[model samples]
Target: MTCTKIAYVVAGTISIFLGVLAFHVYEVYNQDDPDVFPHNLFFPLWFSMDWPSQRTYPFPDHIQYVDRQYYAEILRNPDYAQKLRDENAQYQILDRLFRLKIIRDKFGIPLTLTLDESDTFSMWVEPKYPTFHGIDVGIGKKDGRLYVLYNWHIHSVNLFEDINGMIADIGSQFDSMVCSDKPTVVDGDLVTIDLLLPSSLNDPNKVAEKCGDREYRMCVQGTYHLHNTSGSPVGVLGYTGVIDFTHLGINRGFRVKSLQLKTTENGKRVLYKLN
Candidate 1:
């Protein structure tokens, strides 16, 4: 082959090699999974990228020495030593990180809430056929007062087959008075009446006397109320609740409507209805 032809062949080979290398690099960087790259290649890259040199804590050696001394003290305590041994392996790794201050000081982001500026409402219900039983609402001071509003529902069903109207007759009283009274104000916070629907609807003696030996599922729905004793308008900051599903089995839950506190022009606090 002529020298010029040979040079052209070599250039073609080099171009193909470069294209394959570029494709591999792109796959390593753009893939959804971080483990796309082999550990040997990934660890160096990750360490260099997140080395924390710019924000390195001073006296790391001293910190390590202190941590070792404290760990030695823990080892001297038989109970603590046994506890450490009983910990899971992953927890042990986290404990080491905490000792080194890597997972402690470096990741110590405190969450704070200013109660005076924030308001919240929450409900806790029994884990039964219907998830709601009671609720609690809190309205934070705006101008000087707080306000809250809520609603809920309750339901009961007789599971036993009705034969000769016997079971139906017994279960009929399950719908008797469940929840009553408006929300009451206590210490400037509006609180709901704690209602346990299951206890009332599923009473064994009552069910036997009224509906015979039968199964009944009960649920509750209603609105909780709040009072603003602070004399100022209130604003809600966050709302949360603990839901119980132990009795109802899986995939059953409760829903609540949005509640808010608003100030009227005359500085009166009232429940804000959503449009």
Candidate 2:
């Protein structure tokens, strides 16, 4: 090749090498600055490169529920973290409630449910003392009727029939408390019953402190606003009493021990304390 031709080829090659090096330097310096995209002219602004500043949240494969703890840790801000925890607690409570079975009507009008505001759905779990596991209690509306659902963990076969049988046995006691002839539904882990509203809310004689051989005592009291299906305003019940959950055996999966619900106004309601 001629020397002139060789020189020209080398010049072109050097220009290309210099151009590539300058582009690499530009990318390294400006990639982190999201604002630099608008000024660039050589390359299309849309041409993308991964930046360290960007973050991603990928969903897990096996985890069915939200990873609340992971988010809390990453959030760092105390207010947001606390909010997340509260939401998680609310979610878990709702999950348990949704799984509960309607106790009274085996087959009847499917009652739609609505809970009090998220802030109102609170719980106080008493630590298990020896054989008597503590109870879980909360109040909500089933269609137009106000009801409370409460339960404790038990050792039992995870079969539907066995759970139902346990509900029938334990529920008999629950029924006596509220004077309810309604049947019970079994949720997972514990026998969660959709309590049947008692026919006789005024019958104080029906409260059962003993079921078969087991002896127990229970009391429930709270005040909450009631709402109808249309989400209209319903009057709030203002009355308070101690929730007395005495010693109860672990056998038969204590569904509802005993519930004593009262209101200032003359409202027809039976709040049974489940043992």
Candidate 3:
């Protein structure tokens, strides 16, 4: 072949290779924008083009649109509304479960409401139905209270050293089911409740070792009080649960496990009772 013909062939090959490379780059960046077409073969090329007209603009808050539709359907359903009301009535005893407050972190990001140390409520909200029982506190009232409009809610509490507090949170709802009106039975039979412990507590040499020898597990024991409608304590209830550290260590997160509750004398205790 002549030199001029060979040069033309080489130029054609380089152009095709460069085009393929550009398409790959565009695909990587546009993965989140599925609507962008031709995968926008030369991503940088679109920068020189007119905005919106030449490039497919990312869709407006599709999640918000879907959420609006979701709530609209809920609003239209009488049964769903009744269900929510029923849940509220069932957990009314826990209406004051936690003294919650909202504050902002250093970056001005509105931090979610967290539980304060002391509060009075003797029922537990099921983990699956937290939205039904969460206390909604709006800020910026005319009376000089601050408010924040948040899309999400806090679903879990950090126990820290408050073991009995955590027990009350998990046990009250179950107790309510057993005895809502009558003087609560402190010496009731053991009833199963949901409990989950952190994976960090799965230490065989430390936590698990104290639980059992053949089967390594971590056991938690705590006490909580039950009250009647007038806010007088009936008695102290005891809770004990075991965690399968073997499974927890492998999964590296929380999973629902069974815990049992019974009544105990104020001074006498079982399981991980604090001094």
Measured by lDDT, the strongest candidate is 2
Per-residue lDDT tens digits for candidate 1, residues 1-275, read 99999899879866865575455555455556534323111101011111111112122122221133433544565463223222322232222223332223423322121233233222221211111222222222233333333222122222322331443344444544543344444445444332222224323344223311212211222222222333232233122111122311221222111222232324433333210
Selected candidate, larger lDDT, 2 vs 3: 2
All candidates' lDDT scores?
A: 0.29, 0.31, 0.31
Off by over 4 Å in 1: 1-123, 130-256
Better of 1 and 2 by TM-score: 2
- All candidates: TM-score: 0.17, 0.21, 0.17
Model 3 C-alpha lDDT per residue in residues 1-275, reported as the tens digit of each score: 99999899879876875686555554444456333222222111111111112111111222122134434554565464233223322232122121111101111222111122332222111111111112222222223322233232222223221543344446545656763322232345332223223444333235323322211122233334444344544344343333332443322212212222222334543221111
lDDT of 2: 0.31
CA lDDT, candidate 3, residue 236: 44
Ranking by TM-score: 2, 1, 3
| Winner on TM-score (2 vs 3) | 2
What's the lDDT of the predicted structure labeled candidate 3?
A: 0.31
